[model samples]
Each structure stands twice: as structure tokens, then as C-alpha cells.
Target chain A: MFDIAAVAVTIAIMITMYRAIKGPTIYDRVLAGNAIGTKTVILLVLIGFVHDRPHFLDLAVVYPLINFIATIAFLKYREMGRLD
Target chain B: MIDVMLLLIIVVCAIFALFMKDLLSATIILGIYSFIMATIFTRLNAVDVAFTEASVGAGITSVLMIAALSRTKRYEYHYTKLQRRKPSALFLKVISLLLVIITGAVLVYGTIDMPEFGDPEAPANKHVSPRYIAESEHETSEKNIVTAVLAGYRGYDTLGETTVIFTAGICVILLLRRRINT
Candidate 1:
């Protein structure tokens, strides 16, 4: 069932969280964190369908834009040592 | 039939995403998982959600991960057992796990009270939702009710969400900039 799929994604997210914590490199952690964000977007959409509320998709759409920009900004700062 | 296939794909992708040793591979698998989920959403008649997932989950998130990966090393050290653990760290992990479980339980209980899927007379369908679904195509000239709700009735919320993302990006830039400078 779709419910089971959601649960599976949750478990995967938890595993990704573990990697984020235990990762030896910052990039690994960043990758794991990105994965978590991606999963969250999907989860939001899935929950919307289960509830029959399309409005939740709005949040899903916006979440990635935020997450992506944040990651890029962080990477740019990390590389160049300056935001400006 | 398609539902079952989508569900199976979701499960497989989740498992692969979790257990994959390569961080890049895991991230890519996670993107596929999100894409599969979006397909499932479309199949459920939640077209807007599907669109959002496709845009945000599969598109932007993957790009961000790849960008971050380019800035640093790709693989993480893997060990069979815990090496060194601070007492405080252990305590924090335990507390977080407990909190997660409690929240999960509450959500499950809430789900039990929800109307069965696709019930016509469900309050969601009967209330403002029906009006939106009925009138959105004409009022907004958008055939998708989800698009109308997001861009029309709740336009302000979408703007606020965009602002939140902008703030988060600014904060990340500030934090990492300082680290690199020092």
C-alpha cells in the first residue's frame, strides 16, 4: 500500500540522518541533509494525496526552492570564503 | 495495478537510498525516490502535489546536493561499530529517538480519525474545497485546483514561503562565509 511506501521513505530518511551525523566529511553530511530535504518534499506531496488536500503541494513546491538556494549559498561561501 | 507498481518502486528506492555506501549514489537514488513518489501523487489525482514534487524534490534538491558535493569530498567513513561516543551525544540521540517515536504515534492516531480515502461526502470535499474545485477553472482560468489554491487564494502564503527560502539562503551564506574566512 501507499502507506507502506511512506513509512519506507521515513525509514530511509532516518538512515540518511544517521549518515549526516556520522559522516566523516562535510560533503557527506551535506549530501545526506539534501537527501532528507528531498524526501521531505516527496513526503509532503504523498501526505497531501492521502488527505486529499492539494494545498499541501504548495509547501512542497516552496520547500525545495528554499533548500536548494541555502545549499548553494553555503557551498559558495565555503569555496570563496565570502558571501559578497 | 499501477499503484502497486509505484509502491514497490518507492520501497525499493528507499531501501537503496539508505544502504548505499556512496553518498552521491544515495542522493541520486533519493531523487529517484522523490520522482516515483510524485508519479504516485499524480496517479492519486493530486496533480498539483505531483507537479510540486517534480519541481522541488527531483529538480532543485538534486542540483543542490551536486553543488555541495563539488565543494567537498564525496565519501564518508563507514565503520561496523560505534568508535567514540560522547555521553552528551548519546543522551541527545536517545532523546531525539524518543521524541520521534512520540510524534510518530500521535500522527498515526490522527490518521485513524481521518476520512477514508476518496469518500465523496468527506468534510474536505464538502467544505470550501468543493467550491474551489468547482469554481477554480472559471475564476482563475486554471484547470488545476491546486494551482489556483497556491497562486490565487493563498498567494500571500506562497510569497511568505519564498521569503523564508531567501532568508535561509542568506543565513547559510553568512554562516559558511565566516567559517571559510577564519
Candidate 2:
């Protein structure tokens, strides 16, 4: 069951990778990158299920926590050109 | 089957990243590659490695690359005729291509003798990992084997990783902080 979800997400990741690579604008790439990050968080959890290793769920917990910070930092830097 | 599919996609992403003219798009594609690779690592039961790859490869590296791109040219442009005529540059490119091909061939050849995936009798699985798995709960009182190994038996390595992250945080502060009076 979870394997199906993982395969679906994997398909989504491939589609987003296409956009990330072939997108015409910088914003399109950024959006694709953000989408990939979110899907990665879900994929991480689904993978834990597929492997029957729930102990690794803590790792998935960290993905959403850090991925947003990365996406926001990228957008922030793009807008202001500085970290501060 | 899924692992093979993921591996193929990862290779495609890496090739596209190499061929991209826009540095920003390349960085983004590389992030996707990292994410998928982390997924593969998770599938292989290397949860600690996957965790580190997710945090460092997909998150920190993507952030660092974007920060770097903001300070540099967005596009990777071809050199002007004068710059392109430099013999040293052309020589370096030829040397790099040869080196890369040689190294890749060696690595591929090395994989031919590798044990099948998750082979229970593999030397890597035969060694200390089983002991760690058996003793970790009793020794560290931790339910997670990875956490137990990292934070208990290999505490020094985890300490070093923490120190590195701390140093990076400090460097970011030093570089990005603005003085009130200045």
C-alpha cells in the first residue's frame, strides 16, 4: 500500500525534475525545487513504511522542519540578495 | 525495481544539471537529485546516512548554492574569444575529461565484484553491525539503533558533526550580521 504511494510520489518527483530542468524561468525552477522538497518529506515517511522500519520516522520529522527553512532562505536571498 | 527506476532518474538529473547553462536551474536540479538519492539511501536501510543526506545534501547545499548564486553570475556563459584561446585552459579541460573517464571506469569495474544488495552473508553485515544491533538497546537504552550508534558508541563523531554545524552557524552570523554603528 505504502509502496504504491511511494511509487506515485516517485513519479511526481520525476515530473517535477523535468520542470526543474526544462522550465523556462528562474521562478519555475524554484517552484519545482520547492515541490520536490515537500514531496521528499512525504517520500521519506513512505519509504520508512516500505522498509518496515518505523524507528527512522524521526528522520522524516526533520525534513519538514529543515526543508521550509531552505526554501524560505532561497526565496529571501533571491529577493534581498543577502542572508540578513 | 523501484531502486533501479530511481537510480536512472538520478542519473538523468545529474546529466541535465551538468548541461544546464543557468546556474540557478542547475542548483535546483541538483537539489532534486540529492532528494532522490536520499530516498534511495533510506530504501537501503541506511537511515543515518539518509538523514544526513537529506539535511546536508538537499537542504544545506541547496541553500548554500542559492546564496552563492546571488553573489555570482546567474548564467554559465561561454568565455570570450581571448579567454577561450588560453592554452592552459584547454589543456586543463582535456586533462579533467581524461581523469574523469578513467576514475569512472575504475569505479564501475570495482562494482562488478560487489555483493548483491542486502546479502545477509556480506562481510559488511557480518561485522560489528549485528553486535551493535543486539547490544544497542541494552547499552544505550535507546530504541533507535542509528541514534544509539551515533550518540552512544560513536559519540565523538556526532560531536564533531555538531561542532561543524555550530561553526557554520557562527560563520553565517559573522558574514551576514550588520553592525549597528557602521
Candidate 3:
């Protein structure tokens, strides 16, 4: 069932949180952050099913788009040391 | 069950982020916290709020924090023994601890009178929300009630949000373009 799947994903999120907080390097944290963002998109879609509201997919779609942008920005800033 | 678990993880993330000495790691932990919170909002049927939180919290806020961090030190400064021994620092720490405790106690006290979560007859649910839910489809023809309420009934608020984002983009452009020119 979707509820069971959601609980699993929730556990996965907690695992990623541990990695993000305990990472030894900046790149490790960024990778964990990206992984968390991806999992959130999955959680959002699963939530829509659990709530029986398919329209929530619109929000899910927007989340990944923004997540990608944020990840790219983070990486770019880290490498260049300046956004410009 | 999942909700309770999610809430517990959120608290753990918050505490971990607070104790992190690496600024980037802290920001990433905070982003995970935001992501989980957005999921919780969706579970609570506040899809609009979830959408905003996902975009602003996990996305824009992380990006902004990283950008700011790039301009500053990546690691938090550790006080040397001489600095830690300063009486002024000790006094400031004690005063801040007291202020935090007082503020926390007041906030906890204020929550005692709040209506239970998702109470149908609570003042908020009894107010214009009912009308919005009842008439959103007919008035706005949007399948998502949240979208209808946000883009139709609350046009000015959406406009303000858009304007704010636009202004932020303009400011970033201005600040960054000059560096390229120079």
C-alpha cells in the first residue's frame, strides 16, 4: 500500500538527513542535499496518492524543477566562489 | 504513524543543523528539514502551503544561504581559549540562554489555547475557508481548490509574491552584472 511505501520513504529521508549532517566534506553535504531533494519529490507524489488528491502532482512537478535549479546553483557557487 | 515519525525527524534535523560547525553542511541539513516539512504540509491537505514551502524553503533559501556563505567563511569560527575565558563572552552567553528560555516558555504557554490540529469546527475552518471551498470550483473553474483560492480569490497576494520574486531577480542581476563589467 502507499502508506507503507510512504513510511519507507520517510525512513529513507531520515537516513539522508544523517548523511547530510554528518558528512565530512562540503561536496558530500551537497550530494546529500540533492538526494534529499529528489526524495522529497517522491514523497510529495506519494502524499498525493495517500491523500487521494491527484492534483497535488502539480506541486510535485514544480518541486523537482526548483530542486534542480537549487542544486545547480549550489554547485556553481561552490566551484566558482562567486555566482557572477 | 508516518506523521509522527516525520515530526521527530524534523526535530532531529533542526538540532543537528544547529550543532554543525561546517556552514555548508548545516545549510544542507536545514534544506532536508524544509523538504520534510513541505511533505507534512501536503499530508495535512495544505497543498498550497506545501508548494510554497518546497519552492522557497528547499530551493530559494538553500540557494541564498549558499550564496551568502560563499561571501563569508565556510566554517564557523571557534573561540580560542583566551576568547572563551573572557568574562564578557560568558555574561553574553548567560543572558542569551535566559532570553531563549523565556521566549520558549511564552511560546509554549501560548500554544495551550490553540485548537487541536485539523479541528473542523475551529475558528479558521468556520471562517471564509468554508465559503472558499464551497464556491471555488464554480467561481474559478480550477480543479485544485488551493490554486483557485490563491490565483483567483487572492489575486493580489499572488501578485505581491510574484513582484517580490521579480524584485529579487532584478537585485541579483544588478549586483552580479557590475562584477562582470569591472
Query: Among these predicted structures, which one has the highest lDDT?
Result: 3
Isolated chain A TM-score, each model: 0.88, 0.83, 0.92
**Model 1 steric clash pairs:** none
Backbone clash pairs for candidate 3 read none
Query: Candidate 3 lDDT, tens digit per residue, B52-137?
Result: 78777877777778778888888999999999989999999999999999999999999999999988889999988888888889
For model 1, the stretches where C-alpha displacement exceeds 4 angstroms are: A1-84, B80-99, B130-152, B157-182
Task: State each candidate's clash count.
Answer: 0, 0, 0
lDDT (CA) per prediction: 0.67, 0.80, 0.81
lDDT of candidate 2 over B55-157, digit per residue (tens): 7777677777777777778889888988877999899999999999999999999999999988898988999889998999999999998789889999999
Query: What does candidate 1's lDDT look like per residue over A1-84, in tens digits?
Result: 656776676667657766765677657766776777688777667666666777777767766764565456446645664344
Over A5-84, each residue of candidate 3 has an lDDT whose tens digit, in order, gives 98898899888877787777778888888888888888878878988888777788878776766677667777687666
**For all the predictions, what are the DockQ values?**
0.07, 0.61, 0.65
DockQ of 2: 0.61
| Sequence-dependent TM-score of model 3 | 0.87
Clashing pairs in 2: none
